[model samples]
Target: MLSKRLVSCLDVRDGKLAKSVRFVDTKDIGDPIEKARTYYEEGLDELVFYDITASSEGRDILIDVVERVASQIFIPFSVGGGIRSVEDATRLRLAGAEKVNVNTAAVQNPDLITACADAIGSQSTVLSMDVRRAEPCDAVPSGFEIVIHGGRTPMQLDAIEWAKRGEALGAGELVVNSIDADGTKEGYDVELTRRIAEAVGIPVIASGGAGRPEHLYEVLTEGRADAALVASMLHYGEYTVGELKQYLDARGVKMRMRF
Candidate 1:
């Protein structure tokens, strides 16, 4: 089996690393470049940097920060937020991001996904979905809705349908982030993750609500996620990436162990 990836997320707002609960009450955490280097040194498989407020603030991603963080980490680095065009994606690539993630822009114009994939390879195009559990309805039969603009707006689109559509539109990977579970430290929404993972053929990265290593294990196995995106746990010094990897490796989850 392919080794499951452990990705540390740096949610930055105005260049300072931040953390939020269910997409609200965000507070600055630490220096993003310092944290990125720390995680990379701890053997993190990947790192994702999101300019969390860029889209909502009607601005472009902080390319200077992306470049700075990219210079510190050698792992696969993915950047998102406020990327609106193929040129934006290409700019991030030139700034040193291995993958460019599109969330709000992709939801607004899905063709942007195909366009980015065409400009950069599909393998480097990531579709990030900020989702929240909702009442089951005809429009959202899957009971999950897509929220955009840093979770400030609900798009009324079905999460499962969007995942499948994103794959068809040339998204090589999916980051399914559950707004309901974000920063709770409870655990991932395995059911929601499993639904999207099974609905699409592309790799799924389960994001939000990871409190411990066991949570990662459950999401990787029961959730059928190809990777787990962690924020609070790593951002607050609750656990290091190597410790999480060691825990998962001991539980028989395939991991790229450094020691």
Candidate 2:
């Protein structure tokens, strides 16, 4: 079995690392490049930097931060936020990101997915869906609904359906973030993650509500996720990536045992 990955996410607003609950009350955590370097040097498997407010604030991702973080960290990095077109994706890739994450723009124009895949290959394209589970809205049941604009504007799209669509459009991976669970650190929405993982064939990275190592193990082993993405836990010195890895390894959860 492939080892489960430990990915550290940095929600960047104005080039500063930040964290929030349900995408609200966001406060600066630290510097982006410095934070990214800290995680990479600490043996994180992957790093994701999100320009959290770009979509809602109506601006492009902070390229300066992306450029600096990319130059400082050796680990594979993925970036998202205000990424509108293939050109934008290309710019991020050129700026040192191994992959580009798309959210609102993809929902607005899914054809952009095809355009991106044609240019950057599917493996380098990541589709991040910010989901909030609402009971029986419109044509869907009590499942996940996609939210854009940093989880402010609700898109009338079903998260599971979008996952299928993303896979069809040649997306290589999915980041299923639970807005309800974001920053709660209670635990991952394993049930939601399980449903999405079952519905799609690509690797799914379970995000939001990861408080402890067991949460990561549960998400991978029980939720059937291929990986877990965490932010607040690592940012606040709650746990280190290596510490989580060791915990998982001890539990027999597949993990990268070597740096």
Candidate 3:
């Protein structure tokens, strides 16, 4: 088994680090560069800088802000939002991102994955799936459905099946986020993550609902995830990557402490 990883997420909007609950009601938390510097200094494994609304609003991710954050952080950075073509991936990489994450565009054209993989190598492409549960029933649906545009528009496709399709389409890694669980800090949607991990051969990154250090350990140990993506909990000064890594190492989760 791979040692679990702890990644810090930076969701930026209007040039500042921001976070929202269920992808709505966003509030700027702090200057993005400053926040990113804090996490980088705290020894985060990797950093994900999401231009939260770029895809939905139809514009390129803010490279100026990206450049600002990338200038200060030394960890591998994954930048997403409004990346629709292989060219888009190339430009972001040249802008100092290690990987490009695509969601809405890939769902619209699954071939984008193959194109992107061919252009930049699959390792440089991270397929970020935005998912949400369907209406309540007797039991939770065995499959989650893709929710795009920050979970506002629902895609009529099974999330689990889409994950398998993404793997076949040449995505090197996957980050599965629960719209229902994002920023709630209750914990990750572990069951949802487990199913996706079981469905794909690549690493699965569990995102959203991470509130405490234990939540990190639980998702890796119980949910069987390869890595975790955390935002609000870390953004709000609730805990640092170093703090979580130390806690996990002490608890036998086997993550290397960065600092």
Q: Estimate each model's TM-score.
A: 0.95, 0.94, 0.92
Tell me the deviation in Å of residue 53 in model 3: 4.2
lDDT by residue (1-259, candidate 2, tens digit) is: 6778899888888778888888889899788788778778778888898886644332344777777877788878999877899998998898888999998899889988888888988998999899988876764564688888878888878898899999999898999999898888899999989999999999999999999888998998999998899888889998887898889899988888877
lDDT: worst 10-residue window of model 1? 52-61
Model 1 earns a TM-score of: 0.95
TM-score sort, best first: 1, 2, 3
Better of 1 and 2 by TM-score: 1
**Tens digit of per-residue lDDT, candidate 1, span 29-102:** 88889988888888989999887764434234478888887777778899887889999899989999999999
Model 1: runs farther than 4 Å from truth?
55-61
Once superposed on the true structure, which residue ranges of model 3 sit more than 4 Å away at CA? 53-61, 135-141
Residue 95 deviation, candidate 2, in Å? Answer: 0.5
Residue 104, candidate 2: Cα error in Å is: 1.0
Clashes of 3: 1
Q: How far is candidate 1 from the true structure (C-alpha RMSD, Å)?
A: 1.9
Q: Choose 1 or 3, whichever is better by TM-score.
A: 1
Local distance difference test scores for all models? 0.90, 0.86, 0.83
